[model samples]
Every structure is written in structure tokens, then in C-alpha cells.
Target: MNPELLIAFLASTAGAATPLIMASMGELVTERSGVLNLGIEGMMLVGAVVGFAVTLGTGQITLGLLAAMLAGLGMALIFAFLVLTLQTNQVATGLALTLFGIGLSAFLGRGLVGQTVDPLPHLHFPLLSDIPFVGPLLFRFDSMVYASLLLVAAIAWMLARSRLGLMIRAVGESPDSAHAIGFHVIGLRYGTVMFGGAMAGLGGAYLSLALTPMWVEGMTAGRGWIALAQVVFATWKPRGVMLGAYLFGGVTVLQFHGQGFGLAVPSEFLSMLPYLATIVVLVIICRNPQTILLNKPMSLGQNFRAD
Candidate 1:
């Protein structure tokens, strides 16, 4: 591979992986508090459409990103109320949320289809950006890309060292015990759920506002599910999520780049590459029960009532 090609591939990988890292990181924290949210895909779609609409209306990507987060937060609130307050089945509620989000985004985006906006500008380091491989690889991305990396570092630090992190883990491990210790398990879960929604929304915003600067139905292309699988593949570890997201991102970029490099595989197969890889990773994870059991939140997917 040419050095230039290698650099370009790595750069694109970072761009592709940004949304996954941000969304999964939020989900990681939410899961750490023992709440299972299947609504990320829905939330992401909501964010994408809302973000695109707002940006198109205001001509400000910043405002669009903010609206996207707010839109996702709104969706999370609904989920939290159903699952956390009314005690709905977490799995069913999550699935329903995904469906709702798909429909809502499609409906909302109907007017904006085929519209385009100027893509966000990449950040440039005057002196450092010109340096060989490191410069292009590290310095050329937009603010959101760099922010996602920082978010990963920040999340890792918080989970590993912060008192809040310990409390969240305790809730996930044993909610009853955490409650007996006077912790507000339900409240914490709500907060994390909202956070995850916001991050997922931000990821969706990245897709429409930065990558393509256009609105299209189902543009997320089920990346939300990929993010969920990422959390599982990473076994709830922050760094693992980053690695898995980028690995999958590479697979995503590969199919598009593959034929260009003389890979004779058909276009249809290339498009299926990422999802197929997701299934394989999931199978590998299921095959190693210990890997999951050891790291998975003890009370994951279970609801608790204080009555």
C-alpha cells in the first residue's frame, strides 16, 4: 500500500468511527448503571433529521448539533418514563423506540430530502498540520472528530477513577444493595439514559452535518445497531469500544475502497460487509461467555422499583 493511501485510509477511518465512539461511550455509561436502551438507533435517526433540519433552517451547524442532542434527549425522556417509571419491558420499549424514531425521522425529513448544506470545515494546525504522517492523521479532522477522541479519554477516566463512576458500577452490579446504601439508582439511570441519547444524537449529527451535509431517509444506515454491537464487543470497556468502533469503521470504509484497489468482490457483498462482520463479532462474544459474564453489568436489562 502506498504511504499516501495508508494515511488517507486511516484518516477516513477516524471520521467514520467518530459517531460510534461517541454513541457507544454514552451507552457504556448508561449500561454501567444497569439500564438497557435499545433506542439508540431511533435516537440517532431523530438526531440526524432534527440536526439536518435545524442546520438547514438556521445555516449554523453548531445550532443544528445542539438541536440534535435536544431531540435525542426528548426521545430518551420518553423511553425513561416508559421503562423506568411505568416499568415497561426494556427490550420491547427499546425496539418500539427504534421503530418510532425511524418513522418520526422519515416523516420529519420528508420535506428536506435531497437538500444539501456546506460541510463543516476541518481544523488545521498551522505548524503541525504540515508534518508528515502524524499531521494528516491527527490534525486534519473537524472539531467533532477531535471532540469524540477527547470524550473517549474523558469517559475512560471517569469510569475508572471517579466516585460517580464507582456509584454507577455499584448500581449496575447490585441495584438493591446500592439502593440500601442510599443511592438513587433510578435517578442515575435516567441521567445516563439522557446522556446516551445526547451522544447518539451527536453522532447522527456528525453524519448529516459533516460527512455528507445532506438529508436522506435512513441515512444512518443502521449504524446505531453497530454502535450497540460495539458496546458488547468491547465488553463495556471504553478503550475496547474505541478499538472496536475503528475496526468496524475500517471494514465500512474497505468495501467502498476495496473495488478501487482491485478486490473483485461484488458491490452487494461489499455493502453487506459491515453487518456481516457485526454478526461474526456477536457470535464470537456469545461463544466466550466468560468474557461477557466477567465484564457485563450484573443487573443489566433488569428494572427495579422502589415500592
Candidate 2:
């Protein structure tokens, strides 16, 4: 009810939503090229561990972020090689990637467990950050938070207004047509896949280096899956993805803020709110077949092989 309270809630939602925004946005581009990557969760895990380890070893968050992206890129490259080059089942390969990421990250992170680092600092825009209601709400967040918003805006612009966006959309709709027209389908898809991997890795880094600021084996806790679902729930649109992310973030932050409002509940139930909301939203979006068909990528999840 209070403006300050609302601002705080919204701010928390932004923080909570950052990783999902990054991950889903990445998946969005990947799918825009007609490739479904179910390995997002695993990739995020790898990013988390790699990011934490690098930061721990070097005490440099920037390098840590870079390492995470590279690690995620490696994972994506493997997926692309298998599914695109080798023509493996996209779904199955994606699942394998996820499993490998989970195990590999845990194994690699074994020694780094329990260690912590200083969380990313929030940026303060002197004059702007001092404004009454707008300051903290808009100008006081870490670089990643701002970067996530900018990334969304950039993606929306690129997908809708840019020529490259048109090419990408065309490829996703019909890779055969794209290839026949002399647009290197495989090359384009590879680039998108690597970009997706990089974003997923950044999401993982945000988790370890910002949100929790520590390495806990499998710290992602299914957020990657939620991000994947977000892409579908958003119907492959960047605007929709951002909205869904914040709404989901709100659900996530509610449990923490509930106690202050005297909304007493079991901790377990409170913790389940976010995931529960996710299932509910998915069912809502999925129940209507027309909605799915209206915006669904025609060639999504299908392998494109040049004959």
C-alpha cells in the first residue's frame, strides 16, 4: 500500500527476475533459430560453478563472469555439434547436456563449496539516485540488473526492427527456405546457440556472484527450467518474457516479504509459491491450443539438415 513498500517490492522483484530474464532471453534467440535447448538448467549450473570458482581464484568478479560465459559456450558448442552436426535428437541431447552440466558442475565445484565472496555492489546515480520515489526504484541496482533490462530492450529492437531479426525469424519459421536463399542456416543457428549459452552462463554467474554470493552445488534450483518455461509462456516475444519474468520474480519475493505483512504460513508452502505459480501460469497458457499455435515457432525443436 505504501509507496516505499511498493518500491521495495518492485526492486526486489527486479533483482529476483534478473537471472530469468537473461536465461529466457537467451533461449528465446536460440528457439528463434528453431533450436530448442533443454540444457539451459545444466548450462546455468556450469556457469554458476565456473563463475564462483574463477571469482574465488582471481578475486575479480569481471573475469569470473567472463569465465562463466565461456564455460556455458563450451556446453552449447557440444550441444550444437551433437544435434546440428551429428543430427541427434534435439530433446534427448539437450537432456544429456543438462545432466552432464549438473554432474560436471558439482564435481568441479566440490572444493569451492561453502566459500563466499562479496556480492556485486549496487550502482548509485548521484543526483538521480537521490530522487524521492524514483531514485532507489530506477537508479540503484547492480550493473547486471541494468544490463538485463538493456538486454531485453536490445533484443526486442533487434527481433522486431532489425534486418538481422527478420533473417532470424525467417530461419526459425523455415530453415529450408533460409538455406535455399543462401543464408547459411547452420552458421546462423550456431551463432544463436553460442549466444544462448553465454547468456545462460551470465544468469548462473548472477546467481553465485550476486544473488547468493556463494557457491552451493546446484544453486540454480530449477530457475533455468523456469526460464525455459518463460520463453514458452511469453510466446517467444521479448516483451512477454520480461513481463513474465517480473511476475515470476514477484512470486519469488512474496514469501520473503509476506511475514512483514502478517501473512503467516508454513515456510515450505511459502517457498513453493514461485514454482507453484509457474505451473499455474504454464497450464493457463498451454490449455488454449490456438494461443500456442498463434505464436509458436513453426520449426521449433526440429533439426534442420542440409540435403
lDDT of each: 0.92, 0.93
Residue runs of model 2 more than 4 Å from their true location after superposition: 1-6
lDDT of 1 at 14: 88
How do the residues 181-269 of candidate 2 rate in per-residue lDDT, one tens digit apiece? 98888988998999999999999999999989999988898999999999989999999999999999998888888776567798789
Clashes of 1: 0
**Model 1, poorest ten-residue lDDT window?**
254-263
Instruction: Give the 10-residue window scoring lowest on summed lDDT in candidate 2.
Output: 258-267
Per-residue lDDT of model 1, residues 165-191, tens digit only: 999999999999999999998999999
**What TM-score quantifies how close candidate 2 is to the native fold?**
0.97
Please give the lDDT score for candidate 1: 0.92
